[model samples]
Target: MAIQSSKTVSACLQWVIIPTGSHICMAEFFKTSVTWVVDFHYEGRPRRWFKAFGPHDDPFQQMTDTLKDLYGDRAKLASVRKATDEEELQYLRGEEPKNSYCPTGR
Candidate 1:
């Protein structure tokens, strides 16, 4: 489910469940006025895509809130931080970063 805000900008939230029983979520911010283009793996075995949109200011919070709302108490928000360039690259390449924040409480 995507949450649309009353702004001209939007953000994307993506997540993947790893084999270690941890989930990694990434939030990418962008403006609605500009054409945002992202090319990466979207379909394959053991891979899924979930997207949500919110205000451009704080995508991490929006993502966390959306998860919590969807999963209720079962949702546990772990560390949230900005993904470095290398981390983003690794994610684009279908690799989880070593420094990724995984949901450990689940």
Candidate 2:
């Protein structure tokens, strides 16, 4: 038989959350069998990076927990919301859209 090297398998989710009145927080969630990695961005730049080694089976839960621990009362968890299509486009373009939620910033 031929020898083969094992490759790591992972899943990723990209989303933006607006926690109550706070500025938009962009997040990317990456999950593998042994760990979870999250990257957070603000105004198209890296803000925070987090990684957790897991015995836990749920990646979503890990993401939620990480967010909760990072931004507490200043951000309301129940108000966490997804990014709009325009917001995603703006982020990818590294510039603010014409009708952006926060109109002042570029």
TM-score of every candidate relative to the true structure: 0.37, 0.27
Number of the top lDDT candidate: 2
lDDT of 2 by residue, 1-106 (tens): 2333334433342333334422221222122223223444433443322233434455556556756686653332232223456654555465643324435431
Top TM-score model:
1
Q: After superposition, how far is residue 28 of candidate 2 from its true place, in Å?
A: 13
Q: How far out, in Å, is residue 27 in model 1?
A: 16
lDDT of 1: 0.38
Report the number of backbone clashes for model 1: 0
Stretches > 4 Å off in candidate 2: 1-63, 72-74, 97-106
